[model samples]
Target: MLLVLVVLGLAAAAWARTASRGWGLAALGVVVVLAAIVLTVRPRPATRLPETGELEVGGRRVTGLVLPLRRPSGAQALGVAVLAVLFLGAAVVTFVTQRPAPPDAVFGMVLLAVFGVLFAVAALALWAASGRVPYVGLTPTHLLVFQETAQVEVPWSDLAGVAPVVARTGASPLPDAVGSWVAVRVRTGSPAASGVKLRGPASRVVTQVPGPTGTTTAALIGDVHWAVDPVLAWWTLSYYAEHPAERRELSGPAAVERVTAGDLR
Candidate 1:
């Protein structure tokens, strides 16, 4: 996907050098293509268990799903599709209604330059969309997230607590077009340290964590929030926490000898 965008962006740049105005359309096309790519890339399924032979967390099972947060709903996708069709129709009508003479060399060059700029902008938009959160994982001990800049792993043990932070839909500076997200507050070890905030549909899982040591409790926010069943996640964790016998930790040579002799228990 990234490769295709790069190729399109390069092509747009070349076209912009000759006809600047064409850049706009090329750029728009790039953004649309990139968005489509992100929406189409399927997320991997959640890990159900640790790799074989590895020591499992004592009395703690880890499990959860990581899904794309900004996926467009059926209605939203249809609406956008309709709008695109209408816009395309308008562009076709305009092209058919007016016939202009060929541009002189200088005019053509200027148009090409404009087109290049537009294409560059579109390519950038595509790049930005690519950075959107791809998925999130809730485990017994941590919250794993793939953000545009980096993979964030928030260990439950490190978290002093969790809370719900609200950002209204259409809120300034947020990436999404509609609906705010439940923000998570990670307590800082020091007073000077800053808390991290995870937002958007990606933040849905954070809201499921038991809390009140964290943030303001809005009225039945859970009803409106996008979240997995907290109880289920909690229950799974609790099972691991209680089943210490299932957990294993490796010991020294005696342990290896016992296993080789088929005396491992």
Candidate 2:
């Protein structure tokens, strides 16, 4: 994650520098500070097992394990740490060597402020990533997706179809290959048979869901990218699909009741 931020930060700084060197320096400083915060505030791996629990809905049993998510790989962490040290050293050097000049001092301060903001943002991201699965989960009742601040819940009964999805990182404007993702179609119960779409990056296993009739008809879908384990997500979804009775559909006031009940558990 830090690596991604660093790359992006540098790219943005490069762009900013093309227009204004001072702004570019400020941006670089901001990126450096953000990287530092990320390195310091990341979540450690799970040291103890999560609370093994289950929720029953519609007569199906949904088991859950709250695992602690790590911030970044060890190698990635080390790389960021090293880069941070180097950047800090450079900043210090620039400050000391150029302190006599007013313009240089102002530039240094700008860089300092920029780095401060960047690190602050990185720290926030680390905190968010550590607390919970930002926007993904499998439950007996429904598939929950979090996009930014909005949350969407799709009940098993509403799931009309599922398809594979894949996303890759590259310079190509078009996706070169289909990897893993699930494109779920929900039934809106309208005359037009219209539905909503929810997609995630996951493995091919998502293509198969145990339904009343049998496993679902799997389709090879393209153009989806995921940040989490698609195979695990598939496992969770499959569990719910096989035990449809365990799921429930709640809205408005009912939704509040369901949450309250779950919290008491």
Candidate 3:
């Protein structure tokens, strides 16, 4: 997560540099600060091998890394904390400076309450993010993608295919902020009769792979959407789907690089 943020910060700085001198310098400062803090306590990657070893599923040992929705970064927590403090300070000031029975006192009180609530919510979010957040697990027989409040799991048998998804605006030539992502196509229910019809947000699904029975359901995997190395993630999912027997090779970094180049182009 820290790595991802650092990259994003650098990218932002690069863009800002082209716009103006002061904005670029300020952006560069932010990038440097984030990079310095990240070097000391860098968050782990979203994808990782299970800590408790291989999982048992349907009498078979499933081996593979679990790619969670995303990892939290210290910089985000710090930013949240600062905002919470500012909100709380503003609320206190509003309450303390209010005149009793004044025409705008009621409005001031309400504003103070709102700030207090915002402060509390931000603090709680910081706490949750600081702790261990739930994550998606990727196994030999299954792929779990965690959302805000839910998780979807697709068994290897049901997983039809995986591919890269490039985001695009409707009839717009502008590039999206998030360059690319990976989506996992899963087969749901029995085969459809006549022509296959899979329904969902068509815009989100970049491309479709023929399901096990020609008809299939497709949904985006939010977990790998913001991965540090989306290309590697796509390669991993595609590799496992194509070669399920090569589960052991999914553990090492060198092995992963051998399959899907060491860096993003």
TM-score to native of every candidate shown: 0.34, 0.42, 0.53
- Among all candidates shown, the one with the greatest lDDT: 3
Clashes of each: 22, 14, 1
- lDDT for 58 in candidate 2 is 43
Candidate 2 RMSD to the correct structure: 11.4
The superposed Cα distance between candidate 1 and the true structure at residue 16, in angstroms, equals 32
* Cα-based lDDT for every prediction: 0.39, 0.43, 0.49
Better of 1 and 3 by lDDT: 3
Model 1 per-residue lDDT tens digits across residues 104-194: 4334334434444544454454456544544444443544444444444555544443333343343245464433233333444522123
Identify the runs in model 2 with alpha carbons over 4 angstroms from their true place.
Answer: 1-96, 100-116, 133-140, 146-151, 169-179, 187-229, 235-265
Task: Output the TM-score of candidate 3.
Answer: 0.53
lDDT of 2 by residue, 166-232 (tens): 4452335664453555555455452112332323423323433322343332222222223334444
lDDT of 3: 0.49
Per-residue C-alpha lDDT of model 3 across residues 59-164, encoded as one tens digit per residue: 5665546543454555566654543443344434445544343646445445534644664576566557656544444664566555444345567677767766
Residue pairs with backbone atoms closer than 3 Å in model 3 (clashes): 66-138
